[model samples]
Target chain A: MSEQQTVGFTVNGERHTVSVPTRELLVHTLRERLHLTGTHIGCDSSHCGACTVDLNGRSVKSCTVLTVQAQNAEVLTVEGLAGPDGLHPLQEGFREEHGLQCGFCTPGMLVRAYRFLQENPDPDEDQIRTGMAGNLCRCTGYQNIVKAIRYAAEKQTAGSV
Target chain B: MIPPSFAYRAPASLKEALALIDESGDDAKFLAGGHSLLPMMKFRVSEPAVLIDLGGVPELQGIREAGDRIHIGPMSTENEIIGSALLQQKCPLLPEVARWIADPQVRNRGTIGGDVAHGDPANDHPAVMLALEADFVLRSSQGERVVPANEFYFGTYFTAMEANEVLAEIRVPVLGPGTGYAYKKLKRKTGDFAIAAACVLLTLDRGICKRIAITLTNVGPTPLRASAAEQALTGKAIDDAAVENAAQLAMQICDPAEDLRGDKEYKTHMAGEMVRRAIRQALERAKEAK
Candidate 1:
């Protein structure tokens, strides 16, 4: 008999409270409880960044983080990447640059690149590759994904200017 | 993969956390960063009935300068260390090595204390700590005690850390003038565990090795210090012959397991290669320091 704990956290600007088992992972809480399926679980291990999410202003693998650990923390998933003003630049860039084939790794890639671009607003090609190394894309060979992130960086900077 | 059901406590203070550990006894584990423990729990390799979350403890959360040593809080993340101007100016080798540990996301979460207390030879920080001759401060409800990095590890996935004890701080001595360092790791891919890695810290006086410490990663049950290699280079001119002899001595200490990375022979050879590279780089940095 395991005890259940209640955790309250902000997700994509919304406050939500959920009672889950201590063993529940943040990825499961987002997908099963909050119904945010955008964060996928590729490798249960931390190797695959498919479950990467922005927790408390920094990107972390949600699968490796317990839901209880996220109490009072702010989380941003791929579902929150957009605004009231249509798709995010990353979403638009993916479409513009053909960043996905199967699209399994896109959400994680987009979310990670979201944080990556914020960390390094004007990243070079090598920086983009190194920053996105945590997220693995088996399809599309990562060339187009790199192009997509590059496109987003340019578009974001242009919009800011 | 779901971990076994366990009660989790996010204690507000280090005293409360240690009390929880004392109450739970060996069935409890302090969760720091969770990059290492969570993965093992997901694999069903480590099962603890209670998890003491040290994430909220403010006591174990920053790097500070005290006397001649830098006190690194247990909960300090890799990214924090990497971006820490204090550490970058004082202990650049750590931040340089932290960048090579994993990608950006992992660095944002993984902690140096977890890397050391976890006691995995494959983890980069252990060898770096051993090479730096760092000291780990372990605390329990009883009190606090400092353990040197070299005497800490007992075996693979093992350390001198007691069940009731928590890694409070990692106190690393400030590098004096003329010190040089480098961590050379060869992994299959980015974020992968090292196939064979070497961390070298040395001091050179007038182009002769005054002091040197060489440590190998993932080539043994624990991070092995190549004392013989250090001996071979100390007080000797770090020429090609001395470097080659030291690398060979480093190879003699390797007892690696064959995995997806490579076989024993290849890993041993790679260990020597990494040692050679680390020594050469450390020498160059030493000359630059001079």
Candidate 2:
């Protein structure tokens, strides 16, 4: 059993309220407390970006951030990326471009890429490599991951999904 | 895994935080973004009795331009430095180095002050700070004092910061016109720590070197200044041959010990390569001057 402290933050455009310990990681709060298990935890060491999320419009390793550090911050998890119609452009681009293999790292990759595109919407393959280098995929050797980002860039540019 | 149980305090002000740290004494640890401290805690390496969270201390965050110097708060995140137009335009070398720091997530939380405060030779920013001739503002209940980067780091993970002191800000003087800068690294993977890294900042007068600074990272017990290399190209036109020779001088400064990432001789050799590359990059940047 863990003692709880009052915590509040915006999760995916909705105000989600939860209580966690001062030591509770944002990753654990999302997975256990709020039940947003879609953001997988491959390595809690922040080496693997599998638990990446958007905090206050920036991509962060949730495993490294305590939920208390997230109080009053706007957060966007992988589960919120999809639209009412279906998958977001990045999701479609990943599906059409084959960005994953084992799929464990996809959610984190998508979230990281989602923020990357907003920052550098028209980055080339090389820039994509450098920008997305933080997110690791043990299954695929990054060739297809670069392709997915490129597809998203093109889709976002043309304004046609 | 959860971090070991510890009391926590999020002081709305730096004063309160420092007081808490002072009140708690040796058992307390300052938690910034937790990019460094948290990982160590998870691994059970350091289980401090209490965490004085610096997240609420607004005084410790942000990058500001002041009096020919860039005053970066100790809690200024790597992501903030990379995204700051002021730092980029004034000193492109910083964001250039910041980009290669870690992956994006760590950058978002891993802070410059934390990096400097940790004083790890493996940490890239301290070496760059040495080349930049940066000064650190340390605060405790007593008062504030500035420590030059060269004197701040005493050894591996050892700095001059006192137990009660908090790193408040970093002061960086702007490189005068005709100045050029570069940072180069060789990591097995893009996100991995550098086997060896080099930061070079210099000024040229009509193709003749006027000033120079060189620092190497992850090559010794402390991030080191390449004094021999700096001395080599003082009056000469810093060309490929000059860079090659200075890189050799940088190799002479490395005292790498064997570890998981690389062997001693290999790290020594790579230090030369990084210096060579960094010199070339700085040269490319130098061309932009009038």
Candidate 3:
């Protein structure tokens, strides 16, 4: 009963159309079919947020979303973080603040921070912790990660002004 | 961890979705947000042959005020619920409770309807729904039916919703003046299910308790309404003794299944503790309510 459907979506401003089985997860489609392996799958259950991605302007765990359900949707991944100018502020903050140790949860962290900033540009330390609660990191104890988000928030605010 | 092979259909409208489910037979499952069902599918706990995606149904979205009540589309995500100004002002309890659910990514995709329909005691919404005394609108090919949240849940993963029915809307009465509510959840960590959570909707007339509804989450086969606890404080000027008595009454009804969270004794005690804390908070808010 595996039904294949042609799903068309825009990823990081690039249009992609692929035929995928209905049961294929969005994270799998992005990693395998599109070869954008930036999205990592930590816990196959929806608990871990390593598969976080932006779908239609909202941060969603791609592991739980079926690829076929994302037809005509706009998706943003960790690979789409940097622009032509340089690394995105979040990426820069991660580098500057030493946000990652193992680097396994960085992609998801960056993407989730990207959307979290969009939702709350001037979030406090508590807000950052709560907003980014979906994602888990076995390393760094989340101290650097929170600092990185603060760094990005300040940088973006300063740049905007 | 991949879900078994299943044909998927995304219907553009509610009518089309109902018709597709009818045609697909009983082996078909309605997919909403995919947070609850997909995880089960990954574990092979549920293996439906067909998945009817309801994401495209326009009627199953949005939150609006209708007369004295609020009509929330079943498809509205937890984030959407948290962001709704209408709900924030009219029914603050919902948005407050929604915040305590999973986390940002999970909240973005998890729908209130899905949480209620799943009928999982651990799900935060069912307890809140019972506390607020919400109503659910179930739509099927036959017609539409309205069921109150108190009567909707049967047991773990068992709901009053028929196989062919779709949760169309959730209706909750707007909280009036002097009504204070709180949903206190005790979980191990972020995105974790509650050890024992409590939802309290309290109304006070002057210094005396006018009305109150106390409900516990993840403490039983279904979300348990602490009716005895509520009755204990109904007309009293809630003091330490009343709160303690109410909490004990709430604990008496708990039958939590032991797992990683805690053993039966700890869970049941936590249920009472949560009720105690929630009631005290609700009492303070009720005094501040205007």
Model 2: per-residue Cα lDDT over A60-143, one tens digit each: 989988888888999999999999988898999889888898899999999999999998999988888878877899888989
The digit string of per-residue lDDT tens for model 2 on B1-290 reads 77987877889998998889889979888988788899899889888888889988999988888989999988888888888999888877888888888887788888888888897789889999899889999999889999999899898878999988999999998766678888888988866889999999988878887888999999998999999899999889987889989988999879987898889999999999999988887777777874
Candidate 2: residue B214 lDDT (0-100): 91
Best by lDDT: 3
> What are the TM values for chain B, all candidates?
0.99, 0.97, 0.99
Clashing pairs in 3: none
The RMSD (Cα, Å) of candidate 3 is: 1.0
- Name model 1 segments beyond 4 Å from true: none
For each candidate, what TM-score against the reference?
0.98, 0.94, 0.98
User: Which of candidates 2 and 3 reaches a greater DockQ?
Assistant: 3
Off by over 4 Å in 3: none
lDDT of 3 by residue, B209-249 (tens): 99999999999999999999999999989999999999999
Q: Which docking band does candidate 2 fall into?
A: medium
Q: Compared with the true structure, what per-residue lDDT tens digits does model 1 show for residues A34-64?
A: 9999999998788889999999999999988
